[model samples]
Target: MNSKLIKELPDLVRNNVISQEVATTIEAYYQSQQANSPNRLFTVFGVLGSLLVGLGIILILAHNWDNFSRTVKTGFAFLPLIIGQLVVAFSILKHKSKTWKEASGTFLFFTIGSSIALVSQIYNIPGDLSAYVLTWVLLSAPLIYLLKSNVLAILHLIFITFYAYEIGYGHYYSNETPWLYLVLLGIAIPHYIQLLKHRTNDNITSLFNWLYPLSVTIVLGTFVKDLSELGFLMYVLLFSVFYNLGKMPFFDTQKLRKNGYLIFGSLGIVVLMLIMSFDSFWYIEELVFFAQESYISILLFFVNGVILGLAYYKKWLQSFNVFQYVFILLSLLYLGGLNLPVLGTVIINILILALGITTIKIGADKVHFGILNYGLFIITALVVCRFFDTNMSFVIRGLLFVGVGLSFFLTNYIMLKKQSSKAKTL
Candidate 1:
């Protein structure tokens, strides 16, 4: 509610601009609206306070650990868990506010982990860090939905990502697959869906948007056992899926900064294209597509294809992003590169140039300065790559840099003028 507007209501009524009844009604309505809005700060503080208190208890207990007997240590291990459970139970039964539920749920989540760790330490239980984390994550997964806690949901994602890295890429367990991470991720999807449906503009939803793709991107490498060269192609397909997903009406309607899928997908494709533009990337001694060890990559490629096909069926092409079609081009290029590496390199350079020009056009049409500069950066990056790879003279390279610099200045100047004119008209 606007405090100034509220203060003016009486003045307006005194001046006969509004009736007394009207001012009263307006004040009451705003008061009701203010009361109904969620108190985000309170929720944040409550959750933070719970975390600090939980840590404080752990520290105090740790200080006197050597002095305590086994019985007392065992009781202390269970104490935080019991207290947390009581808090959660109360929050559920009493139908407490979101702050209460979130704070209690967060406290309970840490307590669960603490209790496990304490009991393990107290009884000399044997387990690796990965197993301990996995157990903690599995136990806390229920709290995300049970308490309707977004914080817990985000924490769950982080923990699962860590677990994937530990199981998939850890020194002791490099050969093992982190397949359980996928199932755990699937469990958290419902809550994310609910957030999108009911709280579309929420900060938590934005966090999920960023973290979800990032988590996938980080864990994707863990699935690559052999045919490491094919990993590049796998990432291309994955990013295409991300780009297409971002093009959907749900994400497309949101602000660009909030749509991590679009940003990651676009940037991923561009970076890969730039890397492959080099002749060295296309040169291969052995190209194996159908090896038994490459099954995961093949499966992911097929799945990504299906997803892209579905996106196309749903009219994703109407948006006409160049990166959306790069996956197809790159797929073809990958096969062709095996025989004619130079041809593949040339095609990639052409594709990147085309992508940059298309981006520049789109930015101009929309009068978006950021998009315009991004396109310029793309061209600039390509030129830089060429400078290193080619035998071009320093003078030629410097001229190219100068030309790119001029383009950047001119494009930005034109955009600013357009914005100024548009603003004046408004």
Candidate 2:
């Protein structure tokens, strides 16, 4: 029970709602439950302490490092790694301690990177940032498995994505083959899977939730160079994959941020559709042709279709989500290309308005303020966007804005009144 309910127990006992013995038993049970809960603060501090100590050691060693000879410098570079390895090994073998495991794992992870940097700096290695990051990620990838460390896994995932982005877009401006990052990414997936399997609701699991989607988002843009116009299709299909994953049992239980795939996927599709609704996207001058890489987009579409089909078959997709169906209409609009730009824009605008109304109705029925406000925000944004377009008359735009504002106030007022009435009845 919560604090309010617990506090009310004494009053109930005093009124003879239950005996003193029963009240005592209930209090004792809850106290035991509280005692058994994990200490998250301790874990946070332990991880922070480990990072600070590791950085401190590196800073301390860097003081007057020019005085050391070649052999001495090499030995110094490896010293932290050796120490970190020993600490991690001891944590694994000698104790059943999460703090020790996390601390040592974090230290070792950084130490490995530091060792590589020191060696590179000592020898004047010739490579770009991408190469450096790839090496660091490769070195640290093993720590995830060795220490069963989610922190290291998450860090490695981030680094590998950085490597991919830097190699693909940052270095040389037009690097064609950045596929090695996918191999590196594949190595990190097993650790994430293991974390999910073992401690599905742990803080680390939550971190993985954010990290995986972020990694995908980071690497997603790199495909545009080769795929060209088909990149948009790839993105739509990728978002569909994320949406399907969000409907999975694991992600379904998570909060909005933790369910990054679903949130990003849904919002991504909506935003893309909205952007595509404009005249610029449908203009004849902006026409796009099929590229060889467009086949990849087709493959992704098929994959997305299979996943959505399975979801429908399994009844996982209950009601129509505005995001889910917008893509089909978007694909149709894309097929229309420059021929029916005006019609396409009209259809998309109507679709957005219809979607906003549908979302508001669903939210009101469910009594969900967040969903209701989300719908209102969409309508407000659509109206605001039209303000920039000179094609629409000022008087019509003003009316649109006024209508949206009134709807917001009226919908919220009615919902509030209903909620108040229900509370009074209760």
Cα TM-score per model: 0.90, 0.88
lDDT of all predictions, in order shown? 0.88, 0.77
Highest lDDT model number: 1
Model 2, position 403: C-alpha lDDT score = 89
Off by over 4 Å in 1: 1-31, 291-293, 423-426
lDDT of 1 at 94: 97
Give the distance in Å from residue 425's predicted Cα in candidate 1 to where it truly belongs. Answer: 4.9
Where does candidate 2 clash, by residue pair? none
Number of colliding residue pairs in each model: 0, 0
What's the C-alpha lDDT at position 279 in model 2? 63
Clashing pairs in 1: none
